[model samples]
Target: MKVVLLQDVAGHGKKGDVVNVSDGYARNVLIAKKWGLEATPKNLNDLKLRTKNEAKLAAEHLAAAREMAEAMKSWKVETAIKTGENGKVFGSVSSREIADEVKKQYDQDLDKKKIILEEPIRSLGMHEIKVKLHPQVTAILRVHVGEA
Candidate 1:
């Protein structure tokens, strides 16, 4: 029996995949558990249409990511820190702080996790930060740290 998987089946097939299984297993396990559907002509055609739509949406998301990356290259964020007489910062700046500052100052929301900081900022100066916007897109942002 030919079956179209609705979701991934361990050691079997992935979602939207067509595979041949024994008639008894297809009727008893796959269909009974709603893991897959019979690969009728209508179901096959629907799968093709869904795949096409998914590809289009993925392309649109990539384009948006690229645009955001370009915009970020020209943007700069400023953060304030408390310092002692010797100019040593009290606490290091975190990615969460940078993300919040960007949102508050630039009116754009950015994920803290996406703000890749190899090490927390401990000294006051201009720093470059890398932001992973997407799998294929990365942006470098300038950050200025000043005493408060």
Candidate 2:
């Protein structure tokens, strides 16, 4: 029996893929679980239209992410940390703090996970940070650390 997968199935096929399986398996495992549908003419047409719509949405989202990355490259984030003599901070700055500053400066929300920090910043100076905006896009963050 031929089936159209509505979602990805590990070790089998991905969403929108048409695969062949035993009649009993399709009926019991896939159809009964609402994971796939029988590959009828109408179902095939629906899958085609769905995939086209998804592709269009993905393209638009990618374009927006690219614009955000470009804007972020030239941006600066200023942070005031508690410092002792010789411009040394009492504590380090984490990715979460960086994410909050990005939002405060540019009004753009960023996930803390997207900020790639090797470790917390412990010194006082200007440092460059790496931010992953998308799988295909990246941004450089300029951090200016000063005494509070």
lDDT of each: 0.93, 0.90
Clashing pairs in 2: none
Per-residue lDDT tens digits for candidate 1, residues 1-148, read: 9999999999888999999999999999999999999999998999999999999999998999899899988888999999999887899999999999999988998999999998999989999999998899989989999999
Could you tally the backbone clashes for each prediction? 0, 0
Winning candidate number (TM-score): 2
What range of 10 consecutive residues in model 2 has the weakest lDDT sum?
A: 80-89
Q: Estimate TM-scores for all models.
A: 0.90, 0.93
Candidate 1 accuracy as lDDT:
0.93
Best by lDDT: 1
Per-residue lDDT of model 2, residues 1-148, tens digit only: 9999988988779988999999998999999999899999999999999989999998998898899888887898998789987775799889999899989988999999999999998888899999888888888989988788
Give me the runs in candidate 1 sitting further than 4 Å from their true place: none
